[model samples]
Target chain A: MSAPVVDLPAYEQARRIRDGELTAVGLLQATLKRTEAVEGQQPSSRPYALDAADLEKVHAFINRTEARALQRAEAIDAALAAGEPTGPLAGVPLAVKDNFCVQGTATTAGSKILENFISPYAATAVERLEQAGAVVVGKVNLDEFTFGSSNESSAFLPPVGNPWNPAHVPGGSSGGSTAAVAAGEASLSLGSDTAGSIRQPAAFCGVVGMKPTYGRVSRYGLIAFASSLDCVGPVARNITDTALMMNVIAGPDRRDATAANLAVPDYLAQLDSDLEGMRIGLSPDYFWLKIFDPTTGVLEEQPISPEIEKAVLEAAELLAGRGATIVEDVPMPNTHMGIPVYFVISRVEAASNLHRYDGVKYGFRYGEDTGDLTELYRKSRGAGFGLQPKLRILMGMYVSAEQYEKGYYERALQARTLIRQDFERAFDPEGQYGLDCLLTATTPTTAFKIGAVYGDSVLMQYADMLTVAANHAGVPGISIPAGLDRGGLPIGIQLLGPDFSESRLLQIGRAYERATEDASWRSIRPIVVRNLP
Target chain B: MTKLSGLQSFMQGSGQKDPASKKTESCFDRRTASRYNDCPEGEEVLLPQYPSRQDDEITPEIFDHLVDLAAFHLEPEEREYLRKELNAQLKAIRELEALDVSPEVPITSHGVPFKAAISAPLREDVIEACPEADDIVAGAPETELRYIVVPDIPHEELE
Candidate 1:
């Protein structure tokens, strides 16, 4: 039908290869060819203007690990030829978010600071994926150190474009992770979600992305942004593949003391697509948007786009038809405070984590002779980090400063408590609403054109307000494509559940996916792939 | 930097150009500084001072102190843009002040209630010698025989 090799889902690809119907190497070839066809020139450090020819195509990868991928693919093909047992993901190509350390690839977190820095050890997620027989195709682009809501903040220029239409942004800092999957360059991706990094981009790129419960996945090798808010998760073309990815990546690791010790659930096994008795919530707090008026320095109340609200309402109807109980007007009063709390909490943690990037380490350092260590530190960081990371460091220092900690830092943490409490109350089983999950629109609006809201950090952060609550509450949320808007841009709906509820989220997501499979928009392909032979 | 009359008590030693200087030209190149979004060196911006009850909206003086403490030598344009955004975000973060959180609300470092029961058990602290010492050192920007090299650490004589 649509190119037998690359068009199939991750599980299908693995099955085809594992069953000897397709060679792993042959599938790898098709994947590489598709990547070459769709992915334009790899993005470069900002201020280094891209060629005009490079602007229209999807710039998904920051660096491709073709050599290593070929080796893994060949090994799998050999393992299959010898009649040996193969892993469930025997031939699935994986695009890792640049923040995750992959041994052979230069894992720049879409920043120039780590342009040449290669990790000697891979992240536990990457390690587990490879052990489960997934091939690492390359490192994808992201917001530098996962700082911004859009990929535009990446020091690497020509920010990751939405696969649906490259002129638009593929919401970020895991923009490239979702873009690759949507463009069919990779069947699966490992994207870290800190404050909606994975879910927002996946929603923008029209792919399935999930943020597992905090500590559900090991953060041992992820380049830290806001550690408490960050969750390493999966990005894929379908719910099943997302589940397949979660099965491998979601587990405890001794290296990360914060990793949950509970047994990892087989996410694939839980995707029964049965929504019977599930209580899905609808909060009025989420339907409204808090628009930050830069001119007035105040957050103004506004309704989200009519199209997005309709999508959420329609999704509630569809799930209701599938036997899920719909709970409306759930009062999540503190939901509106997600971004405000995130600003203080994420910044302080970002500031603390970024302290390790001194010049003497593996990453970029000032090249010139320095008079002292302080001078070295200033010049290296000033030169190495982009505006956003520097901005974060400055904010972190200011808020956490001795004089300001009580008012800003500690106060934000307490506010975060209220946001968490909102979820706790809703999911408390014995509480009033007792929502098994909250169903809402993934983003306030559909993917916007590149450069639309990049410079205004406050405006950009608001794009994540609908999704940031899950990050704040350390709950798991999944974003799945609902339908296309009048602009032909994809609309995404999200489902958020309490701790260790990834399986149920995936199950609900799979049910929605099955329901939408026969829709007319489902037949549409990304413009980048529509004309390709 | 114009020294705030009361700021010298805690904020000092930020090598700022005097605000009263008759020289109109900035130490930073105007043309290059203007390329960034806002806040060229000499251009002054003032906003309402509001720690609400405590007079702590980030002023130029406080911004300078934060820049120095963060060990960042920002371009004049960057300084302007960052300071503007920082204050703007601080305004948004003021949403926290309106919250009715009392002193008794325990803070959560993470969303999941990470009781020790669910946390990874600590592994035995056995000294397994690292075999990749050479490999780890190879990543340093400057290195000497098995040691990471750096510029001299400067110190001043004690008074």
Candidate 2:
């Protein structure tokens, strides 16, 4: 029999449907069945006891749009029959990170504050994807207000479990988006990366995720999450599929002023291109952690996991064999400061953005019996938001307070300048490094057990350390699964390139994918997908 | 009611089997030890700390002020936990102070500079009616006659 429809790469899925070998409806049915098999239950605001199955299955979705997906799938097939042009994606199954508004769908941002709000118009990214004939399978879960590095902060618990091994977290705040694709629930997903929301989770879940340069994709209908840092991109099972998704979503839109008003390139055009003569830099700074020593009140540097470091080095070796020159000891001194800088910049923006969620406008509201407007605002905001949002809002207020602005907000912005300059120097042809890209481990370690590092806000923020600098620099980064660690957990290697160079990043990732096509690790499926009937 | 450990028990009934070997107090408890337990065993780690800040955090009075300014009505326990976490996070944010950044360093408000060539020009100021205005107004928690309704304003006269 043809390889299980759900297990095929997205490009293959689209081609099969377009070639008349697979009907869009039939493919969507198979996808739904696979999703049902791996997805235990839709997470919710109502507390429910978790069971053995819930622990083992990937809880990737907050809302399943099966009926809507079926209708869209049938329409695509009907269009094909009538000789009408269907978009390039044809009938591929797709999931959207809930932060992105899908018209008529509840865009929760995984926060109870938005739990009841329904979007009247779709996000530009979602609109483009649907226009490309990708069926919207469902809206996936995420950290509340996209505020946490792990999905544990989502009010709708239990948060998304890593598909590779459900006991662990699927990194966040795009946890559900990556987990859904990894588990074969969807061929592809649209995810946003702000301080590594998409790339970090994609790494943990053993999927290919790209955060195109900021402004590469329009953020028109995406609920704001650190607006200056937020970026929408694709999560897929393979490099080619990621490129396919990027080809459709990466472009300018009038709705988003930040979007680059430039011609979009065909991401698929450069796949399989040689990395020959390309200079890829390796920075020692990416291989460790810098934290404050409580006693001295000074920063301390600690090295990363030897296994993860080995995976990145091995990826470099493999690329070297593919004709790429590896430059060593490239100093990204400011890399260690990404999370610290992000802590201030992101919260200030988050606090400002969330201010729009008052009781008077759309979204969750407090009791009608409130005595006055101020009381109504307090009750609604307190009742609607989960712990993470409250924490961010309070922190944002404290940092941006008149007395603290220069010490925190403006300083963080300047720190951001230094972070950006680090990339500029490394990528500058006139500079000593002159590197086209930098290769590093996507995260400090592989996926950690669910709840392992969730409660500690400080520890949780560090999860994005390796991936956030790219966000700070407005560069594109792709996380590709390199190999499995000793625990049989997937390890990801990241490739970060200069601004607006998503095509080059994808080309590099595609080279790695092609080089490791027959590698034993590539054959290993996620635990949730392994025994599915 | 003490603050949550960096590690937590599966109160959600995640059905995670108890480990053959459990550490003191909790399965993955390392608050006092370090917060990097997620790293491979024996991986040297240094978790962020701020002894002075922890001892003399601005959280007590400032935190309450912040909570009110943010307009949240947090429960006492929740407030305590949030306050502690916020203090811990602030300690971490304090790391930015180490950079010898000067006023001359141009602040990067957005990562990629929005050059005039690549940046979209401002949209013309036009009164384009939102086709979904009614839909949006109707989405409010409480609305009447296309206006979002709320409790009494409780205004006071200026001195």
Candidate 3:
């Protein structure tokens, strides 16, 4: 009778609403119904439990904004009825990661410190999305302070399970955002990336995630993990949806000093553009033949998982076949140093940023056990913070200490300069190695079993090794579903370009997606969504 | 072995053994004795418990000092866990020290210096009341009427 509720791409749903072929109320109801059906249910288990008990099992949403969402949907419908102009993403239902502030909603960022913290103001990105007529459904879970790679680091909420296999993890700290999209709970979602938080989770949940060039989106209200590395971006089912979100949220904001003032390109317009003569760089040192061992803390020099290597090679070949040249061995010698550099900078900044939450101004306070002002400060933070955040704070303190500042913190900053130069060298047309974009695997492996990498912090940190370099260089990178592993987990390949080259990256990505549309590997709908009634 | 006897024997052995021999024997004996104390005589010790106290840059004492410096109050177990975790991270950070970075290389605090980009102009600062100031203050745990209530500061500590 009406358009099928589940699995409808964001663009199509928006179009139907825009055309008045489907009412916003009907779309909202259908999306909510579908979300209720599949949000918390384990897809692998038989006999679908449509009961209220099962709904409670869904850990994806930290706070569901049903009333607000319905109200917003009604307003959009009313606007269209009055013959008013609507933005491109009108009537689209989207999820916001809990890290981004949404006024009147609890924005915990998955930490107990902010467990009851209500955002008094919305992030610039959230405000823009809502202004573009997208309805905010809920806030999703993430790692506490976005410190750990796994969503298990969430102290206040249950770890978000991968929709692909409930036994495995939805990669984090943007796990719930990606999981919400993959499970069809939300048509599209917003996530902040500070070293692979967005792309890794999107890869795990089998969705498209883009970390725009640093400063591309305003950080006005997005919770900071690493101020230098953090970039707010979108997670969606397809490139078009991601681009639509970019259209609304990208460009400089007067509120955020770091927001780039570059002209916002129409990402959708460049989707159908030709890729002829586009040079894609491949770094053998960074991408080829390496498997990280959690047990020994070693990144072994062995052939990468055949599936991942095959996916990258095939994508390169596909681009080359479509008139783009594949350039080999672009040197990024300092790429491996990104992890340590990022660790130093991010932790130091986090230590400084988190100092604001010391019980007096806002968020959690622990004055009960206070013997002095300092005790109150200590107890408040110590009691409020989770394991990973505590550890990181200590690490930040160690590196930034006056004694170790020059050797650890200062040297890391210097190394960051070298890393930035490496990317510049690759992108410079007049320089030795000129390239349009670089290609690499998003994760070393597919979504791992939950608790597999949980206990090992080093192993968890290594999850961002492939993705963090882009953040360090402040470049734009997108993770597109390349294929699936034998276990049917999604494998993603990332395309990295110089600063403000998001349009070019999206163009190359769209070309690859189109070429592989008929292929079995294009997009994988998680079993949870596929099994929905 | 009985707990008291184990302690007694360990103390007596340390006193009786020559200092030179004790150095070598303590390495093996302390590990063996600690392992043996945890298990029955016949039970195999899968892995010996090596004392974490070694010639390391980050020791428990230094870790506590750092925790104090950071103004974090970790519980005993949290401190021990972080002592190990921080050491591991520090080991990884030490690798950066090995890099041949010249002192002349400019430090990059932010990824892209948007201030340098002509298009990204700085906003003019203006004095204005925050609309949500009350809402933000309301979110705090302790507030007196309209103001946030904080612990009284000892004036000497401030100095």
Candidate number achieving the greatest TM-score relative to the actual structure: 2
User: What are the lDDT figures for the candidates, one per model?
Assistant: 0.80, 0.83, 0.76
Mark the regions of model 1 whose C-alpha exceeds 4 Å error after superposition: A50-52, A291-299, B1-56
Model 3, range B1-159, lDDT digits (tens) per residue? 111111112222213212232121112111221211212344332221222557356887788787887777777767665676666566556557668887899998766665666346755678878999889778888888887777778566554
* Ordered list by lDDT, greatest first: 2, 1, 3
In model 1, what are the clashing residue pairs, if there are any? Answer: B1-B16, B1-B17, B39-B80, B51-B56
Residues A1-533, candidate 1, lDDT per residue (tens digit)?
Answer: 65646878999999888778988888889999999998877678746443455547888888888988999999999998998877889989999999999875688888878887878788999999999999999988888898877687787766777777786788888898888998889999999888898888888888898999999999888999988888999999899998888888888898998899999878888686588999999998888765443335455676666777898998898888888999999988888789888888899999999989888868888998878999999998888898889888888888888888999889888888888999999999999998989999888777775644555566567778888988989999999998887767788999999999989999888888877778898888877888887
DockQ of each candidate's interface versus the true one?
0.26, 0.37, 0.21
- Interface RMSDs of all predictions? 10.9, 6.0, 13.5
Among all windows of 10 consecutive residues in model 2 chain A, the one with the lowest summed lDDT is A46-55
Interface RMSD of 1: 10.9
Q: Write the per-residue lDDT of candidate 3 for residues A1-533, one digit (tens) a residue.
A: 33366468889998989998887778888878877776663222111212334323446887889999999999999999999987778888899998999999988888878877999999999999999988998988888888877686776444577777765678889998998888888889999899999998888788899999998999999988888899999999888888888998998898887887888988899888878879999888556533332224454453344677788989999998788999998888887788778779889988887778787777878747697778888898888887788878778887898998998889998998898998999999988768999988887677765444454455567678789888888889999988777777788889999888888988998898888889965544676655455
What lDDT is obtained when candidate 2 is compared to the true structure?
Answer: 0.83
Displacement of residue B111 (Cα, Å) in model 3 is 2.6
Q: What share of the true interface contacts does each candidate keep?
A: 0.57, 0.63, 0.48
Fnat computed for model 1: 0.57
